[model samples]
Target: MFTTKDATTPHVGLLVDKVEDNVDYKKEDIKPLDKLTEVGFDIDPQTKNMMRGLIKLAEKHSVLIDPSAIFSPVHIAQEDIQESEAYGLF
Candidate 1:
């Protein structure tokens, strides 16, 4: 909704339905919405295994990944990208 309309972002040719721009001073000015996104997440036998792989990959680039909320993972991992492991059922 922001990219296609907001002049701050470039035109990415994304398809969006509608946008609301009413600044009515009501109960609240902004309404938060829960959005489900398809994201890549890894789960191993345990947290140790996960940390081992993370450490090994970090050693290659000599950088650590300490993620936090309010930031996108793509922004942090894009510089040192690695091919993801195959998806499977346990």
Candidate 2:
């Protein structure tokens, strides 16, 4: 997993699936959302500002999550809600 410090909060952390040597992406491939609500995230509008955008990879899709959002308690709580709602059986 990838780990990094949060820009907005000193005590919080930013974690991801994998950390690699930084890769480059085309400008056009990066799609921005006006708000986190576009992705069903129920976070504060302030936290929503941390969302960078989405990156298209072949036929798959990936999100460009901001370190600030990753470190946000509100964002984390919203994610937990989504995850549990999607897979309560686990």
Best by TM-score: 2
**Please, what are the lDDT tens digits per residue for candidate 2 over residues 1-90?**
223455443542334566544657898988776443576855555544555786776875556765544444554545543323533311
Candidate 2: list runs displaced more than 4 Å.
Answer: 1-15, 65-90
Q: What are the lDDT figures for the candidates, one per model?
A: 0.26, 0.54
lDDT of candidate 1 over 1-90, digit per residue (tens): 112224565532323333334323333322221111123433323222212112112223111111221122335534643443452111
What clash pairs does model 2 have?
none
Model 1, residue 1: what's the lDDT?
A: 19
TM-score per model over all chains: 0.17, 0.40
